[model samples]
Target: SQGEGPDPYDEILQAFKIMDTEENGFLTLADLKQICESVNLNFSNKIIQEMIEEADNTGDGKISLTEFTSIMCQTGRFKYCAPK
Candidate 1:
């Protein structure tokens, strides 16, 4: 039963994958904007840019999987945290 259940981490990975439409191993502003539109979030560019800035530890103007996971693990109900 343990192995049969879907892992929570898998869901996060899927979400990141969906956001990275170009499969470039990173989430760009355009990619995030498209995802927001698809989900009907209606977030303006300013807000979305701010969101990107908040999570972009590397200051590369894009979110790598590692950066995304760090934010996800830091907030919400996830108990794990990315290693420093």
Candidate 2:
């Protein structure tokens, strides 16, 4: 559709990797804070913590790719259709 550009799922994974600065395979509070600031968003710590909690499905205070994908699907930002 977009002239053979990268898959949408790959794009999402790439974005997650970029945000995971710690290279620990998950997103922590500090990573979120740094990205927010880089994008000129001055979110308070409470707001950031809330964001983490919202997506941290495992309740481990960090967001893994599975958690991120679940949130995206819940928010209608991503939809997965199995091959027919």
Candidate 3:
């Protein structure tokens, strides 16, 4: 049963992989913008700024998987972008 189930983390990892083009385990602001656009979740500047402040745990301008997951989960619901 375990192997038959679709991986829950797959959705989250797929979303991250979409944005992390460089495969550097981090995402730039532009990558974030692209993701938001894909999901039709246009965030206000205030919200985006708040996300960086709250989720950028490492103090790097780039967002790591942990930070991204925390932010995504905090958004009321997880929004997986439809693959293009």
Q: What is the C-alpha lDDT of each candidate?
A: 0.86, 0.84, 0.74
Candidate 3 local lDDT, 1-84, one digit each (tens): 377566655767888898887788988766767678788999875676666677789888778988888777766454443232
List, residue by residue over 1-84, the lDDT tens digit for candidate 2. 577666667756887899999989999999999999999999998999999999987899999999877776676654342233
Query: What C-alpha RMSD separates each model from the true structure?
Result: 3.3, 3.2, 6.5
Give the better candidate number (1 or 2) by lDDT: 1
What would you estimate as the lDDT of candidate 1? 0.86
TM-score of every prediction relative to native: 0.80, 0.82, 0.63
Candidate 2: deviation at residue 7, Å?
Answer: 1.9
Q: Supply the global lDDT for candidate 3.
A: 0.74
RMSD of 2: 3.2
Which candidate leads in TM-score?
Answer: 2
lDDT of 1 by residue, 1-84 (tens): 387667677777888898899999999889999999998999999999999999999999999999998888877755334343
Clashing pairs in 3: none
Residue 6 lDDT in model 2?
65
Which residue segments of model 1 deviate by more than 4 Å? 1-4, 79-84
lDDT leader: 1
Q: Where does candidate 2 have its weakest 10-residue lDDT segment?
A: 75-84
- Count backbone clashes in candidate 2: 0
RMSD of 3: 6.5
